[model samples]
Target: MPAPEGFAYVVRGADVVISHHGRPVTTLRGRRAAAFLDDVEREDPQELMARLTGNYRRGNERQARNHPRNRGR
Candidate 1:
């Protein structure tokens, strides 16, 4: 498939380039390059954030609910 509007990709002699929202983020080389590129483009921001931060934005409700700082005056 073609790259999305805000994204771009290129297939050099033996490498695959990948970008996100238009910024270059990764490059894959060798036989599995295409698969790697596919995976990169299909990544989910929410899943990534949850993996990195231990909680997704929607899952932060508990903290906001119990924190006095977030309480309405």
Candidate 2:
């Protein structure tokens, strides 16, 4: 199927990254790729990527705050 307008994808080795207007929105590989393929048109790609990637970003923020470099102010 043709990509949605303003949305595009590129394959980097084993992974395919879906981007919106030059910003990488999400990555697809293995099961995630298969699962998202069915809902590509039905869902908001930006919202979906945010929901998925947001979790990791939150964790990284927590880890950074707890790191030794951040200790003692």
Best by lDDT: 2
- Model 2, 1-73: lDDT tens digits are 2223456667676676877668887788987776665665689764555555442234466688889999877
Clashing pairs in 2: none
lDDT of each: 0.54, 0.64
lDDT of 1 by residue, 38-65 (tens): 6656885334323332332455677888
Off by over 4 Å in 2: 1-14, 18-26, 55-73
lDDT of 2 at 34: 67
- Runs in model 1 with CA error above 4 Å? 1-5, 36-73
Q: Candidate 1: which pairs clash?
A: none
Cα displacement (angstroms), candidate 2, residue 23, comes to: 6.3
Give candidate 2's error at residue 29 in angstroms: 1.3
* TM-score, every prediction: 0.37, 0.41
